[model samples]
Target: MNEQDVYDAIVTRRSTRNYKPTPVEPQKLARIIDAGRYAPSGGNSQTNRFFVVQKQEIIADLIKLVEEAFSKMDVYDGMYRSLRNSILRSKEGGYLFCYNAPVLVVVANKKDYGNNMADCAVAIENMMVEANALDLGSCWINQLRWLNEEPTLLEYMRKLGLPEDERVYGAAIFGYPATEDGKPNRVPLPRTGVDVVYL
Candidate 1:
C-alpha cells in the first residue's frame, strides 16, 4: 500500500461489533497476526503472546465465562462506562463480550512486566489496522483483560496454553462483517475531541 492508502486505512478504521458466521481465512488471519507481532516493544522485549481463537466451542465457552465474571460485579458510580455497561448487560444475561465474532485474538504478556499492557496495546492497534487493510471487520475486546485475575477465567485460559506467569492484557475480534455490503463501516465518526497542545 502507498502512503495515502495507509493514511486512509488508519483514518477510516472503525470498531466492528457485529459479524457474520463466515470465518476469516487462515492466510489473511496469519498476516494480520504477523502485523501485530511486528509491533514495536519497549526495550526490545517482544514477549507478547497471541492466541487466535477460531474454534466455535471455545468462543462459546469464553463468552460464558466472561459473562459470568462480569455478572458477579456491581456497577459503581465512577467506573468506566464500558465496564459498567458490561456489568449491567451481563446481569441481564447472555452478554456476548466479543460480539459473537468468528475470530477472537487474545493478546497476553508477562504479568510482572511493567510494559505488558502498553506492548499489547501497540500490537492490537497494528493488528486492527492490518485488518482494515485486509477488508476484515475487527473490534478490540476488553472484558477479558478486566477479568484477567478471575480464577475461573485464569484456569480456563491456562487450559488454552496461557502461561501461569502471563496474563491477558488485551484482545480483538476479526471476521467478515454482517453488514449488507459485507464490508466494515468506514464512515469515520465526527472528529471532535482529542485536542492537541503545541508546547
Candidate 2:
C-alpha cells in the first residue's frame, strides 16, 4: 500500500449509520478483524476479545434488550446528546442500536484492566479504517458499552460468551452501504475543533 493510501483511509472514514441488510463478504470481514487484532495494546497484552455477531435473530434480541433497558431509565439535564437521543428513541418503541447492520463486532476486555477502554478504542478505529478501505460502511456502537454493567445486558452478554470478568468497551457494526451505488461515502468531514501544540 502507498503511504498516501493509509492517510486517505484515515481522512475519509466516516461514521455510517444506515446500512444495507446484505451481509459483508467473509474475506473482507476477516481482513477488517485482522486489522483490529494488529492494533497496539498496553504492555503488548493483546487481551482484547472480539465477538463478531452475524446472526440476525441474536442481533434483533440485542436491540430489543438494549431498547428496553434504555427506555426504563430516566434522562438527566446534563446527559450527553447522543445518549439522550438513544433514551428518547428507545422509549418511543423501536431503537436499533446497530442500525440493523449485518455484523456487530463487540469488543470486551478485563474490567480491572487499566487500559481496557483505550485498547478497545484503538482496535475499533483500526477496524473502521479497514472497513472503509473495503468499501464497507461501519459505525461505532456505544450503547452496549454504556450499559456494560446493567444486569439485563450483562446477562445477555454472558449468554453470548462474554466472560464474567470481562465487560464490553466498544463495538463496531459493519455492512454494505444503503446508497444507490453501493459505495460508502468517503467525503471527509471538516475538522474544526482539534488543537495541536508544537514543543
Candidate 3:
C-alpha cells in the first residue's frame, strides 16, 4: 500500500458496532493479527498473548457471562459513562459486548507487568487499522477487561486458555459490515478537542 492508503486507513477507521454474521476470511484475519503482533512492545517484552475467538458457542457464552456479571453490579454516581451504559444495558439483558462480531481477538498480558495495558493498546490499534485496510469492520471490546478480575470471568477465561499470570488488557471484534454496500463506514469524524503543542 501507498502512503496515502495508510493515512486514509488510519483516519477513516471507526469503531464498528454492528457487524454481519459472515465470518472474516482467514487470510485477512491472519494479516490483521500479524499487524498486531508487529506492534512495538515496551522493553521488547513481547509477552502479549492473543486469543482469537471465532466459535459461536464460546462467543455466546462469553456474552452471557459478561451480561450476568454486569447485571449484578450496582450503578453509582460519577461512574464512567461507558461502564454505566454497559451496566444498564446488561441489566436489561441481551447485551453483546462484541456486538455479535464473528471474531473477537482478546489481548492479554502479564498481570504484574507495568506496560501490560500500553502494549496491548498498541497491538489493538494496529489490528484495527489493518482491519480497516482489509475492508473489515472492527470494534474494541472492553467489558472483558473491565471484569478481568471477576471470579466468574476469570474462570471462564482460564478454560479458554488464558494463563493464570495474565489478564485481559484489551480486545477487538472483527467481521464483515452489515451495511448495504458490505463495507465499513469510511467517513472520518471531525476532531476538535485534541490539542497539540510543538516542542
Candidate 4:
C-alpha cells in the first residue's frame, strides 16, 4: 500500500462503539488477525499472541467478570477518563465495554519483553486498519489490558489458555457497524500536527 492508501485507512478508521447483532465472517476476521500477527516486535522476537474470541457465551461471561472487577475497584486521581467512566458505569450496572462486538482480539506479549505494550499496540492498530479496509467496525478495548494483572482476571484468563508468562497489552473489538445503512462511517476529521520537522 502507498502513503495515500495508508493515510486513507488511518483517517477512515473511526472507533465504532455501536455494532450490529450480526457476526463477522470467519474469513474476513482471519485476514484482520493475520494483519495483527504481522506487526513488528522488539529484536524481531515475534512473540505476540493474538487471542481471537467469538463465542457469545464466553464474551458474556467476560463482560460480567470485567464489570464486577471494575465495580470493586476505587478510581484514583489521574486515571484515564474512559476507564473511570467504565468503573462508574459498572457500579451502576450494565456496562458492556466491548459493545457486544462479534469478535474481540486480545494481543498478548511476554511479560518480560521490554517492548510488550509497544508491539501489542502496533498489532492492534494493524488489525483495526485491516478491519476498516474490510468494511468492519473496530474499536480499542482497554479494560482487559487494565485488568490483565489482577489475580481474579489473571486466573480467568489462564483458564482461557493465556500463557503464564504472557499478559494482555491491547485489544480490539470488531463487527459490522450498527448504522442505518449498514456501513461504517469513513469521514476523516482534520488533524493539527504531529510536530514534524524538515531537515
Candidate 5:
C-alpha cells in the first residue's frame, strides 16, 4: 500500500462492534497478523505474543467464561461504562464481548515489562489499520485485558498457551462487516480532546 492508501485506511478505520457469521480469508488473516508482528516494540524487545483464534468453538467457550466472570463481579461507581454494561448484560445471559467476529487476536506480553501494554496497543492499532485496508470491520476488545489478572481466567488462558509470566494487554476482533453496503463506516468524527501543541 502506498502513503495515500495508508492514510486513507487510517482515516476510514472505525470501531465495528457487529459482524456477520462468516470466516475471514486465511491469507488476509495472515497479512493482518503480519502487520501486527511488524509493529515497533519498545527497544525492539519483540516480546509481544499474538494469539490468533478463528475457531468458533474456542470463541464460544471464551465468551462463556467471560460472561461468567463478569457476572460474578459487582458494578462499582466510577467504573468504566462499558464494563458496567458488560456486567449487567452478562447477568441477563448472553454477552458476547467480541460481537461474534470470526477472528480474535489477543496480544500478550510479559506482565512486568514497563512497555508491555504500550507495545500491545501499537500492534493492535497496526492490525486494525490493516484490517481496514482489507475492507474488514475491526473492533478493540478490552474486556479480556481487564480480566487478565483474574485467577480463573488466567488459568484458562495459560492452557491456551499464554505463558505464566505473560498477560493479555490488548485484543482486536476482525471480520467482514454486517452492514448492507459491506463497508465500514468511515466518516471521521471531530477531534475534541487530542490537543496539539506547536513547538
Candidate 6:
C-alpha cells in the first residue's frame, strides 16, 4: 500500500453518496474489513460481525426490503432527522439507500451488549478511513441499523446468516467514486459545529 497520511485520509473522507458501478478490489475490501476488525471493543469483545455483500441480487433485495419497511412508517416529532427523511423518501418511492455502491458491508453486534453501537461506530469509522486511504469512495449507511429490529428485516438478515442474538448496528457502502476524475471528493468541508472548549 502506498503511503497516504492517516490524518489526511481521516479529514478528507467525505461521504460519497454517488458511486460508479466499478467494484472495490477483493484485496482492498479485505483490508478495509481488517481495519475494522482491529478496532477496540468493549471488554475486548471483538464480537463485531461483517457481512460483505457484493451480489447484485442480494443488494437489490436489501434495498427493496429497506424501502418497503420505511414506507410503512410514520414520522414523529423529535424523531431522528435522517430516519424521518428515509420514511418520507420511501413513501415518495425510489429510495436507493446505498447509493448504488457495488459493495456493502453490514456491521452487527450483540443486541444485549451495552457498547454495541459504540463498538460498531468505531468499526465503521476505521473502515471508512481505510477505504479513503485505499482510494475507494465510502459512506456510512444507517438505514439498515434503523431497520435492524424490524421483523421482516431481522428474518431476512437471519436467512443471510445473522445470528439470532445479534443485530445490525451499522453498515457502509464502498465503490469507486463517480467523479469525473474517478477519485473521492477530497474538498475540505470545514467543521463548524463540533464545538471545542479546551479546559
**Residue 168, candidate 4: alpha-carbon lDDT:** 90
Off by over 4 Å in 4: 1-3
What 10-residue stretch in candidate 1 is worst by lDDT? 1-10
Residue-wise lDDT of candidate 3 within 43-146, one digit each (tens)? 99999999999999999999999999999999999999999999999999989888989999999999999999999999999999999999999989999999
The number of clashing residue pairs in each candidate reads 0, 0, 0, 0, 0, 0
Question: What C-alpha root-mean-square deviation, in Å, does candidate 2 show against the real structure?
Answer: 0.8
Across 77-164, the per-residue lDDT of candidate 1 in tens digits comes to 8999999999999999989898879999999999999999999999999999999999999999999999999999999999999998
Kindly indicate the candidate among 4 and 6 with the higher TM-score. Answer: 6
* Per-residue C-alpha lDDT of model 5 across residues 37-154, encoded as one tens digit per residue: 9999999999999999998888898899999999999999999899999999999999989998999999999999999999999999999999999999999999999899988888
Off by over 4 Å in 1: none
- Predicted candidate 4 versus true structure: per-residue lDDT over 109-159, tens digit per residue: 899999999999899999999899899999999999999888888888899
Q: Residue 112: error of model 4 in Å?
A: 1.0
The sequence of per-residue lDDT tens digits that candidate 6 reaches over residues 3-91 is 55988998899999999998788999999999999999999999999999999999999999999999999999999999999999999
> Each prediction's Cα lDDT score?
0.95, 0.94, 0.94, 0.90, 0.93, 0.95
- RMSD in Å for all candidates: 0.9, 0.8, 0.8, 1.5, 1.1, 1.7
Q: List the residue pairs that clash in candidate 4.
A: none
Residue 60, model 6, lDDT: 94
- Give the C-alpha miss distance for residue 25 in model 6, angstroms: 0.7
TM-score of each: 0.97, 0.98, 0.98, 0.94, 0.96, 0.96
Could you tell me which residue pairs clash in candidate 2?
A: none
